[model samples]
Target: MTKFYSLGDSESEQKRLLRQIDLYGDTRGVAFGAANRVVELGCGAGANLWIARQLSEGSYVGVDVRQGQIDAARRRTRDLGIGNAEFQLADAAETGLKAGDFDALFCRCVLIHQPDPRPIVTEAQRLLRPGGRGVFIEPDGPNHYMAPGKEALMKVFHARTHYAYGDGRGSPGAARNLYPLLVNAGFKDVTLTPHVIVATGDDADCCRAFLRHWMEIIAPVADALVAEGLITSRELKQALREAETVKPDLFICHTMWQADATR
Candidate 1:
């Protein structure tokens, strides 16, 4: 139950996530199209609600582990006058929702952070009714890049992919295992689409926004990483110090797998 996003509920972080929706959100998960009821796991800050609406005009139950995220989602739903939404504070793997209550299940950029994603996959299976669909989007952790040498960020990614953090499972690169995991969890009609995040110096806004994302993840875990000898305190300070002034020779991209399946 690691809130692996690690970026706490700050106004700046909220704004960054809102911008992330615009920059990276796509209709690739529209496999839930027209479903009558949906469940969105790890639905942080309700930014994805708009996209959720496009996929289905039905009621949605947004689930997350952090109370702050739940509050943020509720606040956004209220502010936007969105009527058919509800937010719950719960882990994705143990949602406490009734089984077979949803027509579709959705999560994006969620599973890779888990040390063992099997429980979440099984929970997704349990949440949906027969014939229900799910769209799970996860990144290729091993392929993520930030150019002009983002030393600290690169080290962080390397450590994650090398299984230095998890229970020797290396869940950061779990996107590659989605097919087998979902299949073994009793889901059918499994399909996967290749998704990519590509931002270059020309894409200034997205580049900076992505930089903010790196800082968000980096700053929170700097001390732990330093204590573990994975990163130095000086390197952590330098990374945070240069956050705003980081060179835009920045080229960022990562491969991702978007799995669409049925229960």
Candidate 2:
């Protein structure tokens, strides 16, 4: 089965993800400045690649398993007249990129969808030169929020998504723990930085869009949950109704980390 992260919802979520990436910049200091030659793993739609090419002034390659996304990315790059970026169809856990072929490896909102993120890190380490770094950004599900009527629904929403789709890993708050994983995989000087991107003011529109996107993703399971009495129908209806009226205090603590480890 094509995973939810590789499906249509994620395709639509790309724009919101782009805005978050813009806030974080290309990669961390390790991948910035003199670093060149970059690869984006799970580069859905090529948004990050576009930004990364601009920041690093380097050749950028993006890989994804979805051919649809690769096609979309190609079209976007061509439309934008961006010549330094390219897209390919490849798997995140097993991209056939050459060893030491890239100075930096970038993945955003990708690893959490994997069945095992360790191999993804392992491959990233292999792709990087001795001092090359990997930048990974993921959402901190625990920090996601809702109002009083929707609080319980939000909790269940996150739990079901994390437990079912999170690959038995909590990448959201895994930023700190990834340091050890990188070190164990023979990556040296592994470090992590926690970041939060607030959605406010005119950005409220973006938040509203994101909320709708997530609601669409959760709708199937939510109906099941209500059917099984996991959540009351009345509660679900209230939350759905409130989704429109609630003053959008959209905040996502993107537990992103930039890890630099040498080969």
* RMSD of candidates 1 onward, in order: 3.0, 3.9
Off by more than 4 A, model 1: 3-5, 8-12, 26-31, 55-57, 160-165, 168-170, 237-250
- What global local distance difference test value does model 1 have? 0.76
Which tens-of-lDDT digit does each residue in 1-263 have in candidate 2? Answer: 12454234355555545554455453434335434788888887776655554554678889888887788778778877777787768887678878889877777767656656788888888888877767766655556655444565575567456644555533545555666777788877666666654444347676566556556656656766666566677777766775554364444333445555556
lDDT of 1 by residue, 137-224 (tens): 8877777787676766677656535433365443766788899989999999999988787888787777778777766655555677
lDDT of each model, Cα atoms only?
0.76, 0.64
Q: Which regions of candidate 2 deviate over 4 angstroms?
A: 1-31, 55-57, 166-173, 199-210, 216-221, 224-230, 248-260
Q: Distance from true position, residue 77, model 1, in Å?
A: 0.3
Q: In model 1, which range of ten residues has the least summed lDDT?
A: 161-170
Best-matching candidate per TM-score: 1
Report the Cα lDDT for residue 245, model 2: 49
Candidate 1 clash pair list: none
Model 2 clash number: 0
